[model samples]
Target chain A: MTAQPDHPDAKAGHTLISVDAMGGDEGPAAVVAGCALSAQANPDIGFILHGPQEQLDPLIAKHRELAGRCDVHHATEVVTMDDKPSQVVRTGKNTSMWSAIESVRSGEAAVAVSCGNTGALMAMSMIRLRKLPGVNRPAIAVLYPSSNPQGFNVMLDVGADVRADADDLLRFALMGTSYARNGMDLQRPRVGLLNVGTEEHKGRTELKEAYDLIRAQGESTGFDFVGFVEGGDISGNRADVIVTDGFTGNVAIKTGEGTASMIGNRLREAFKYSPLSRLASLLAYTSLRRLSKKIDPRRVNGGVFLGLNGTVVKSHGSADATGISAAIKLAAQLSENKFNDKLAARVAATLPAEESPS
Target chain B: MTAQPDHPDAKAGHTLISVDAMGGDEGPAAVVAGCALSAQANPDIGFILHGPQEQLDPLIAKHRELAGRCDVHHATEVVTMDDKPSQVVRTGKNTSMWSAIESVRSGEAAVAVSCGNTGALMAMSMIRLRKLPGVNRPAIAVLYPSSNPQGFNVMLDVGADVRADADDLLRFALMGTSYARNGMDLQRPRVGLLNVGTEEHKGRTELKEAYDLIRAQGESTGFDFVGFVEGGDISGNRADVIVTDGFTGNVAIKTGEGTASMIGNRLREAFKYSPLSRLASLLAYTSLRRLSKKIDPRRVNGGVFLGLNGTVVKSHGSADATGISAAIKLAAQLSENKFNDKLAARVAATLPAEESPS
Candidate 1:
């Protein structure tokens, strides 16, 4: 097993964060608040808010301490989260998001965090940083809000690519395994192919072929191959890592998030039913508040774009200050763990470097 | 709009529930407890537990009140949930699940409920009772454990057939709309097609074609077309009815359920960290208990196999008594609403009686 390298930021005494200041629903306010909070939390961290200085000047003034740590770069345009990734990337030059991507590529920052269009971030990251040597496809590795070390199931390719073949899936399994080991700090992560059923015969024909290939190369692969895992196992924490195509993974994650939100809303509504219950809601507010904090959407908002040459975290467009702050912290932590270095090394050593997508 | 019909169960003094006793993981115990609870809660609904009497007798004796409401129909074997639907129906003679399905076919019971293999239930139900006159395919409808009127999101197939054409999806939409009107008493329930995105260019070729068909027919068909809904909307209660093929729907639901279970487990772990939280956990146990009860899996375990000529509700194989009871209630409710009658009428009016598979 290869050891992960330390981050360049830790050695420099200045933690650099590349922020797409023009991203997300609230735009500059949310991003600046996040930058301020992160800089305050870790004095060592300095944020290069990649957007227009004129638009961000007011936000930087709110946090006096962060004023010194936060500097605004002039990238005039912004990418809407709803825009088509390929179309936007082709047309969007010198945009705040694209500039942020360049920061990571130029080694101006340890990590780039964006809350803009997921597709744009992915396309730009791949184009600028390129894929790790030998990785055919770069999967967007997600850490679901989980319990055990295995609780945080890693769902690959949530949105990077949709129409993947068997070879793409196998490559995802390889990338996903390294991600689980280096990012989550799990040894020999139990890798399971996400299927409708645990039975090998179950799932799409494409999945079946991928399963066979995994089985044929099963022993030689360093991952602790756990055969097929049913959908239920995703939340069960039985498998350390789960792999699936972006189409399915995106739907699965969205479904999970929508359900949790709906349930949370229902619970709130339930508590508001009567006067006595209303009072109970106030008295038990702290407990419920704490519970909600643990499951905060902002905290779990970032998705690590794994299998890339450098580290990048994607946040939700609707994220608020808390979410933005969490994204910054997450990017910092992922960079500090030397997640990309470890991932690149693993892909290079285990598979031919030239196989990676350009 | 079609007026909702009177519930069939309401006409009879004793509502007969045909139970596939041999079905499911816990088998007799699960069915017995479910039947007992159902009978205890709704005295009008009686049960005919169809299986080997020798196997069910002990479980029957455990609840005297349920014994008064229950009877035994001796079918020595069961159709395993793992068996292929076509093979099991052809080879498994006198299987309790098959017999239970037959009971509904012959009008021996008001409704039939099973926790056995879904494929077998779909096969037996389609072969015995048949599809609604103009319905090309039968859809499995479940209450999206997330919805406001607590209205159910009707997803067809749910795993009965893997590949679906445009016509199959359209059939699912029509059947699902009728089900919402009849089952949930919604007037012109909003129908949304489950796709990767809401845009015209968002889905695959088949889905794109289905989208066009839905737009063309929705105005004349009485269903309020809400346009395309992504997986994120499934649990947001965004639309009263959601339509998708058997494969994606099954994976989506399982993903939703798995996520809920995983998050619940994570909360429990997070609360274990502190002395204050542990003490609060004990005191807030009642509130948490109430919350858990409200979101109980047992309350919504059974999924309705829609578009069939008779009422057939499939419970998860791992269903506990709560899940079984939910299935029983759904079965009873469908019988009362005459769900099949309403769906059959709608299909005959809107679509052609015989259509080729897409």
Candidate 2:
């Protein structure tokens, strides 16, 4: 999987991001629209679009700005949302998702973005890009909208693997710290180990061991280890990065998202209950719009797969043009900053030599 | 610990609840006020208030309705919020929390209610009231407000213990099912095992094992086992009872609560942003109030400890009069239905004979 060294774009100064234009619920149109939006916002970004050329060409032609910067790579197959990870690894070689990731591996693109099934995307990324040196398990880190001055906090191992030993957790912390620094611009991110209680003696035995390991690496890694934190701190300003096992982090993130949506729906229903409240809703529309913008999940739609040789951003499966644009922007930003290289260096430096898999 | 044979109210038909009034953040005054409110609402309910007599007497005397129906039990010690569970279990015999639990053990009260440190209360309850036979761990079941017709769903193992194996999770499902049935008045509650994904092969190995165990006992336990459910279903009407390990349950519940509070605060701020919005808020005040009442955490304030020999309800430490009253009402409702005995019987009948701890 090596790019053609003689290719004209190989020496191009602009950053190239691989875009999987299929597999999402919104189809190829949204992906093309999102790429056009990103190209309009950032002139130095280029795309290696992977999908059936027949379907993607018409959509790309609609936007004048994207037509010049985007290059289509024809892929015959697509990975469905219900496909198993193991199945995808074996027979998904020709799919757009696989082709998109291949571009990164072959050095044709700096990062790859997919709005597809999370399990499938993660499995394919791991199999294709492989893990960084000394990393036993890769983690998926998401940007959580919080009350922090930065407006977002990084949380990792959201659903990469359901299990994490003490050593794995330490790896997650190092990776999460690097993401927080690069993504949120925190100089010395305060990392918190998520537990049921903040006390030293709460949670499973693995978490206790992880706490000590993380604290020991804090000085060396340049990130502050803040002992333990609880679920409330995920949305609060208590920590810039919250680390936990995949199971708990995944459940917590989804629960937070669901609860937010439920409350939002309830508020809308309350405002539209009567003619008077409906009139009031019109008056309060601007303020409500401001609040909506502040808490919109679409603004932070990408989940970065850390501990890999290449960077991969997994956007929501049902992402609209705005959500896809956010993911594309994140991918471009990470590619420009060489996030994957920095993350690998951070993991190698902080992870103990003894814990590295031989 | 035994009740006095000659007590005048021993033969009374009314259900008596033991309430620890000293340790909550709001102190005994709120507890007394809550008892008065409950007494006014339910004439057949009686309370045995456990705290310092001097402090509680004046407060109880002010509420004539409570003064007639409440009996004070003097206790000298209080369990601070920071006390360790192991330490409390070993040396917290004289605390009001301990005495309240003892009342339930001695049959002087049908159920015990405490608004104190959760760890200490759980420890004291286990030591005084003991775990039910065949139960390895007792779970704390909570009522989560949902879109169901019942207005709430049951979730269990929420911070009771940080670990749960396959057997333990099966026990949690049984206990949570009993809670939904007795507490929510469901004839046969639908039980769902919480997982990161809804697929059969997803999540940790123990959760997969639990799925099989719970499904096996569905017919005998008289509950519907709905297979695996994700975190989003926790607040929805898809399941009446959601069962999970303590760690995941604890994090999900807190995350939901935090997200709800954050959004609620944002909505309030949006309404008061400008004079037009403020006037809009005034016009929509009634609908907003109705929405607030529907989602208020105070309305579902009790966390019932299941898989135990006696019933114990834990109220939030910072609960005010309305929250305390809600806890008292839950205790009375459980006592009236003889929930503890029914739960024990259900556990014994559904649990395998060989899996019973010797």
Error of 1 at B262 (Å): 3.5
State which docking tier applies to candidate 2: medium
Off by more than 4 A, model 2: A1-12, A352-358, B1-11, B352-358
lDDT for each residue of candidate 1 in B11-61, tens digit (9 for 90 to 100): 445667899887789868878888888877876677778899887889988
Q: Which one wins on lDDT? A: 2
Q: Per-residue lDDT of A1-358 in model 1, one digit per residue for the tens? A: 0111233233355668888998788878888888877776866677778888788888788876575566577888888767777787798887999999888898888689998878788888888898877777788878776554543677777777766788778778877887777666777777888877777767689989988876665567677778887667666666777788787777778888888887787667766666655655665566667777766767777788887878888888898988888888878877777777877776676666655367
Q: What is the lDDT of residue A205 in candidate 1?
A: 94
Off by over 4 Å in 1: A1-15, A216-218, A272-289, A352-356, B1-15, B57-71, B81-87, B126-137, B265-290, B354-358
Q: Give the CA lDDT, 0 to 100, for residue A336 in model 1.
A: 72
In angstroms, give how far residue B93 of model 2 lies from its true place: 0.9
Return the lDDT, model 2, position B203. 94
TM-score of chain B of 1: 0.91
Error of 1 at B32 (Å): 2.7
